[model samples]
Each structure stands twice: as C-alpha cells, then as structure tokens.
Target: MALVGPEEPHYCNHHVVASTGRTRKMTLVRALRPFRVVRRTLAVFTLGAMVIVSFALLPSNVADAATVPVSTQAVVQTAPDLAKICARLKITVARTSLCSHGPDPVDAFGGGARLKQTSAVQEQGVAAAPASELTALCNADGVSGKRIEVIYGVPQDRTNRFSAMVAPLRDMMRQVNNNLEAADAATSQNYRFLCTNGVDVTVRNVTLLPVGSDASFTFDDYVASLQNQIAFGLGPVDFIANERLYIAYIDQVQDSYPFGGQGELSIDDQPSAAANANNDSRPRYSMSAYLDMPVMAHEIGHNIGAVQDSAPHSSKGGHCYDEADLMCYDDGGLYFALGGTLTFTCPGADTAIDCHDEDYYYPGTPPASNYLATHWNTANSGFLTPVVSAATPPTVTGKSPVSQATRVAQTANATATFSEAVQGVSTTTMRIKNPGGTVLSSAVSYNTTTRVATINPSASLAADTKYSVSLTGGVTGIRDLSGSPLVSTGWSFTTGPAPTITTRTPGSGATGASRTASVSVTFSEGMAGVAASTFKLKNTATGAAITALVSRNGTTNQWILNPSATLAATTNFTVTITGGSTAVRDLAGNPVSTSIWRFTTGS
Candidate 1:
C-alpha cells in the first residue's frame, strides 16, 4: 500500500516470492503488527551467499484481499480540512465552515497556490511559469475525429512573453483532451478533441488598453479589440461554429478572480475575418498567460456545460462535492471519477452528519440535491455537440412609413419588417433619432410571427418634424436565431402637418338644423378607417344616447355620421368622436383624439 499527497504522483513498491510450484509477487510493509499471523511452514536457503527465509501462513480474514499489507495507520490516513488548506494557500472561500467539513484539500506546491487563487493571479499580474521557446506544441497526427479550433492572441508588445507559454498551453490542452476522452468513454459518448492546425490556428498581436483606473485590461475589452481587428481584416476570419478563440495577455482580466481562465458554454457567431472566414456557431474562451493543466481543463469544462449551478444541476452549485471530480474547486486529477462514471457514491455515505451527506449539504441557503444524477445521465448524450453554421443576417424589407415618404402620421408606431425572424431587437438595437440625432424615449419590441420590429415613442412625434430610425449591426447588433447580425442603417421620414378639422357640415353651435340631417367632418390628412362605434350622438337635455353609422371617404379624409333614427326635435344634439381604437387611425395607424361639437335640431 502507498500513501501520497492530494496532488502528488502515485507510487508502489513490490517484492517477488518463489513458492513450491508457482511464483507470486507480494508486497511487504513494516507496519503490519496489529493482525494475527499464523505460520504453517518455514524454509531457509542461501542464494549468492545471502540467506533467504520463506514462510507459508494462513492470513486472517480481517483485511481486504486486494489491499495487501494493510495496517491501521494506512487506513487512518485522513484528509485535512479544505478551509485550512485554502487558508494556508492564502485563498478565500465563501463559506469557511462548510469547507472545514467538505472535501479533502489538494496539496499546494510548484505554483499550486497561484492556481488556487485565480483572482489573485489576475490582480498581481504574476506569471505562473517561466517562458520557453516558441515551437509547434500540440501534436496533430492522432486527431482523426471532431476538432475544435483554438486561436491564441497576445498584445503586440508582449509577443515574446506569450510565445514562451505555447509549450505549457499545449500540455494543458492535451491533458484536457485526455480527460474529456476518458469521461466520454465512461459515459458511453463519442466526443473527441482535435487541435486546430495549419491555417486553422491564429496568433494575433493586439493593442492593450487599461480598464478605467485599473492597471489591467478586461476580457470584454480584449474581445472588442479583436472585433475591431476582424472588422479591419487584420484578425482571423469570422469564427465558425466548431471553433473557439482564446486571447492570451499579460495584464490581469477584470472579472477573473481566484481563477486562471474564464469561458462561456457557447457564444453567438459574430462577424470575423480569418482563414476559415465563415461565421462560427461555437463560443470562445480566454486564458491568462499563467495557467496549468487542471485550471485549463476546468475552463474547458464550462464550455462542456458541466456542473452548471442552474436548472437541472442547481444543487451542485457550480461544482460537485467529490474532491476527485474535475469540476470541483479542489480539482487536481486528470480524469473524471465523480459524475462521469455514473456510479455515484455519496460523499460520507455512512455518516449521519448533514455536512457529510450529499443531499443535505447546503452550499446554498436552501439546500439543494446533488443534480449530478440529472445532467450526467445517459439521456443527455448530446451535450457535447458543437453548433454548426452561422445564422443568416436579418435584413429590412419594409418600413411603416416608407423611406423619404411625406405625410407620415405623428402618432404612428415606427415599424420595420425584417427578411427573417429575429430576437433581441429592442430599444437597445433599434432607435428613433430626431434630426438632431437625439434618441427618442421609446419601447421597442419584435414580433416573431410577423418578423416585424416596432418602436413606439413614449409620446407622439412632433408635427412636421423629421426623424430617423437606426438599427445597429455586427456582434452587438440585433441577431437572428443563429446569431447572424443585421446590417445597420438609418431611414428618415417627415411627420405630416398637425391634423385638424378643416370643415364640418353641421357647423358648431348651428341653430334650427334639420332633425334628419347627417353630420360630416373633414380632416387635413387621409383617415385610415372610421368605426361606427366612435361616433356618439346624444340629446343634451334628455341625456339620451343615439346610435349612428360612420363612413369615411378615402380621398377627402372626411368622416360621415348618420343617426340610425331622426334626431329629437327642438333638442341640442352633440356629436363626439371617441378615440382609442385601431378603427379610428390615420393611414399611418395614428389614433385620433376625442373631438366634440354641438348643434340645435329644429322642432
């Protein structure tokens, strides 16, 4: 039996024994005094002038046959508290008490402390290992299955420093591939890893900028710089669905604290320029120049959507409790032994303590069950599939008020129909700007069924004013389901002059009007349609309602209201236009406001 530290290599010592008929290899340790030993026969012989003693004995059944020379000391080699281990490494954990009783801690040595405090590495801008010569680090000969491209970038000024990291980065990636392959084999999946080679791999020299007052730059800022490079044809072609882009820089990343890398499960295909040139359906991840195999594998695990702290895996809260799990915080091994094996042995299965039990462990306030059984099952076999093609870019096919059109309604909602169904087409992407380029306060929404994006201003537009609607494009622009972005452009239109009642047949305050006379109102602009329900005729004295039929003349923009019955004699009749419906809109769909007029009917 052998005992090793959490992160140390395994070691075993063996001794060969010659028996009467067969040769058996046996392991002997000095610490085996507790168990009773029954000896039946003994023999002594001399080989090369050295005396050798042998004995055949009946061993006690107290120990397992597989673990030879087992003793009390070997079985009692307990692991230390995780909190103590973290404290010794100068790393901080959210819950110290929980960690105290959690999993055993992995020993820290040879820059292991830096790996434990990922955020510290970013803050201090510390390098993990010395740089080496630049060379072809990854082996491509054995990769015959599915491949994912990796693009590494560095600041132009720090090329030499980043070049030295190629060897270690290659080693880390190889380990990650090996671990993933082992996991797939255990889970009965067929996912394999391929290193981007030849023209597929990219090495970019980018400009570094400080984030706010901080001395370091952010991953998002770096991504933006990469985008700018792509836009200018200096960066790699648009990432395809199967590729991932990793930017390596000397400065610390803003959000990556206590970790060496950060990544997303997947990313939308944004426009890019590279050898492949096609839009990629996969997401990209980033790493600091200072990284190790375990940390690198951990980030790739995120890309694999493992142990997510949401939905089906909410109970795991970002990681499994098993210390041997590659997804755990104390991860140190190169293989998956927890959820990947599908044979779950709850940590501390025999103990009644809540902290020892996997089910009652509350890494979160509301205790959650270990969701490993839910996500790591055989049913979710396709979790490792890569997204394939980029989505088609959305195009504007039509607008409510056609470009450069006159007589646009002030109350009309600004609408633009796209060539395909799109999402996230809200106020953030679509904007209505006045001639002065000031964005108007408006609510923007997209209708999937109609493929239309509508922007309704908080208030009606200024009459006779010019406004332009702009939609953004590129990575941050509005995108379709496949993440293809829309091309950005602006269209302008002038609002029509304020609509007014130019003439009324039954003039306001008219006296001695015929009881059977119909009323007519003419507007300056063409009306969309008038609803009969919008016209209300009532006798003021009796407060009696009168129903009427309303009709509109398309060319004249006039609304005619004829009472269903004769108006009351010697009575003051009021005709009112009740608005607030699609029925009473202008040609541009602007609803009219309430209008009232009165006339006296003859007796």
Candidate 2:
C-alpha cells in the first residue's frame, strides 16, 4: 500500500456497479443458463427414477442409492462461468489452485472434491462442491488451514530498544485478526477464515553497512543483506508443509516512502528446500519498524491474493481502487456491518480510512469487490481462524540488595532482574536517588542474556545512608519482550555505619615532639569536611592558641593540620577537637569524637 498519497475519493465498488457491468452481467446470465438447464434435466430425471425405482427396488436399496455420492466434476461442468471465475482469479481448491492443469480435467474437482467428499460421505449423500470454492465464486474467497510465521529482524545497536516495537507490532497483529473476523462476519460467503497459527519473534544482531550520500546501497540491497543475515543467523526454516514464513525487518533506519512493507504473493527461493516445497511455495511479506496497523494489514492482504489485476472483479487500480478498502489508498477502517448499517472505526485513528457513514459498506448491496471480501471468509476455508489465547506479559521477578534491606555495601551496584528477557532498560527508566531526593550520577546497562539491569554510581554511596532505586512504568517506560511496561516501584537500601577516626598524629603525652611538625588524623573510612576550626593547637601553660590550616587527603582519607607558625619553643602544646561545633564529619554525617590530647614541643 502507498504510505503517503493524495486523498482520492473513490465511491465504494458496492455502490457503483463497475463500468463493465453490461459485459459482466451478460457473462453472469450466460453462466447461469447452464445451471438452469441442468436443474430442469435433474428434475425430469428424478421424477422418472422415483417411479421406476419404487416398482423394482426394496426401501433399503432406494435409501442406499439416495446416499450415493455425486461427482464434483458435474457441478463445475454445469457452472462453466463460475469455474472460469475461480481459475481466472487463481482461487485455490483445497490447497491446489483451480488454474493448474494436471490430469484433472474438472477444474474444480481436484482438491475441492476431497474436501467436499469428507463432509458428503459422512452425511450419506452425494458430495457437494466445497462451500469455500462456491463462496469465492459468488463473493469473497479464502483458503483455510494456512499458517504464518512472523519473524522480526533487529540490528545490534537497536537491540536494547527493541521493546519499543514489540507492542506496536503485537497490536498490529491483533488489528489484522480483528479486521479479518469482521470481514468474515459481514460477507455472505462461508469459508475457514485465516488465523494466526503461530507467531515467533527472533532478534538477530546484524552489522549494517553505512549508507553513503550518493545512495551507494539501495533499500533492496539492505533487504537482500538482511535476508542473507537471517539465513546465517537462524539457519534453515523448519516450517510444516502448509506453514508460511514472513520476515519483518525492524531496523533503526527508516525506509523510503510508499513502501512501509512489501511481499510476494508466492516466494519460491526460500532459504530451506522444505519451506520452498511447502504448499505451492508459501508467500513472504516484510516491513520495517516504521509501520502502522493498516500498512501491515495491507501488505499481508497482498500476500493472500487480493485485488489482483488478473481477476475479473479487479480494476485499473489493481489492489488500490476503493478508497475505503483496506487494499485501497485509505486505512480501510475496521468495519463490521449489521442489518443495513455499517459499523466502522479506525484503530487509534492512526489510519487513512475516514470513519464516516458514507465511507463504509452496508449489507444487501453488492458486496465490496475488494480485498475485504476476496480474502475474509470465515467458513471452513476462511483465511483466519479463531485465536486460542491472548499473549502473556513480562514481569519483574527479583532485584539485588533486596528492598528495605540495610547494611548494604557502599560500593555495591543496584540490579533488577525480570521474569523474562527485557529491553529498553536505560538510565532514563531506572535510577538511584539518595534520601535527599537527589538522583545519583550513574551508568546504567542491561544484560539481555541475564535479563538484569545494573546501575553503577559514579562514586561510593554515603555510609549509613538510605538510597531509593526506581524503575519507571508507563507506555514509554521500560518494557519486556511482549512490550508490557514494568510496574513502577521503589526499593531502598541503607549503607553500613559511618567511619570514625582510628588514629591521630603526635601521640598523647609525648615529652619532646618537634615544634615544626604538622598534626594529622586517620579515619576508619572515607571522611569529609576537613577545617581548621575542627582541630586546635595551644600553649598548655600560656593559654596561647595557634592557627592552623586543615585539609583531607581523598586517597588516604586522612586529615592534615598545618600550624600557621612554628609552635612556641619550650612550650607544652595541647590539641583539641571541639565536640559540638566540630566541622569534620564522615561521609555518612557522623561527627568525630570530641577529645583533647597534648604533646610538649622541643625547647
């Protein structure tokens, strides 16, 4: 589908009979003529057989004859125009296309007969042509029992942020399924609807070559490279015979416009021979991270064989004729019609389809000859089946330095572990704050393998201090693989006790210490706030105080006191730490013990 385009208002195909209506009407009448003739012939034959059988056969034989299965070939031969439409539209019978010519002279009798036979034999009657094939002839068609696999390609640099795309993609899938269901219910046809058989998301790390200004590498080249990368990363695809493999490349770079996603109706050169050999070569589709629900739904619609130019119902616009159709230029509003009214709305209003009464398809009118009808039958052959269950969300299972635990090491890194691997764990989502509400400067890293996120503070935390670590939760917060956000919660931890002075320079009661020597103190742990007022030197007998400069060595956590002048000669000097007014304190705010110790200077 074109990602960007001018708004071209095209009337619903259901309302405006095509310009080729006369020719098609003639063709339809011609097609119905043979069916009328066959019905008349069967009516005459039934009357004759009933009279003859009653006279010659027992009641049991009559019942047995009535239960005999009829040839599916007879139905197709009688309705030549319907067979022509099925073959021309490339509609499949069972899993085989009606167009393919094998030994099967009856175009509709090949695989479709088997499907009908299964039901007809059980009902003790002639097998009727599969309802899905008949439905496709009358209105929209579908192929049931088809499987699709969704694989996501993630570049190495964007692995951590991969969670950002998860929710959007999952939502897109849900919308796709819902749209299919709505289409199935609105159509008059019956077929097994397409269902999400299985979805697998794999994150493959790839090194993308730099794109040069001259356009050294094209987007196709990148896609080819990514295809090769997937081959090398995941090896071969081991899907079943009916399963399809679709690769969606979620890159950090945006793709060129009008190509949000694209895929082939049938992929022949799959990585594995088994996949290539499966069910007439299952189709493949791809999209970038920059994709919306409508775009994705449109691309996948192409893969399912809709709006093809080759079909009689198709028009000049190919898959893009109806403005309000999903295959059209618009978002094909999620619609379900009831009675005569159309109920329609776009998902999150992020699509181009105008959700107005005029933009929708009503019942009883000619069904919209668009992808909506062509691919959305819910009978046995409908493109989508019912989903079994909803997806599971990821959660946080454990955290380091357990919440409210005390005596945690000052240098320990804070970590959080999730129940499953998660991405988008950055400093913005996870943080540590001191008791004062200041966020600590730290580097955050997430280990995808371990599913753990670690926050390493730039410096050791304050001793005996309480700190809170939090993981933000919201639509934009950290998310798990399924794109569910973590529950916002804070966990606090307290560091061990504050450090104290273990030793001091100039032992107390020393008789003859050098007068020029400086005084110093050593602490049991890191300390701060060294100042002269915290330590004082004075002449013991004269009561003369000496000024000193004070500073702490960060490496050693030692405070040095340098006297302003040489101590008085032949004086007994005393050093004191004023308890109440002392400015010195450890990193955890515990002040040093107040004490006085003296040593006599040399005479």
TM-score of each: 0.29, 0.29
TM-score of decoy 2: 0.29
On residues 1-603, what C-alpha lDDT tens digit does candidate 2 reach at each position?
121122311112111000100111112122332123433442344334223221110111011111111211011011113233333323232222222100101111111222232222222321222221122112212323454444445433233344444433433343343344234122221113232321222223343323333222222323333334333232233212343435354444432211244433321112122222222343333443333344455545544443332222222122322223454331121110111111222221212222221222222232555322332211222233332111233445566886544557889999987667776778877888764456789999998889888999999998777676767644567766667655344455668664566777887888778888888878777654455655777888878778888776658877778898887776778887643211444544344556688887778
- Which lDDT tens digits does candidate 1 get at residues 196-276? 443112333344322332233333334433434443333445332333434343333323222244443221111111211
Candidate 1 matches the true fold with a TM-score of 0.29
Least accurate stretch of 10 residues (summed lDDT) in model 1?
10-19
Cand. 2 Cα-lDDT = 0.41
lDDT of each: 0.41, 0.41
C-alpha RMSD of candidate 2: 32.9
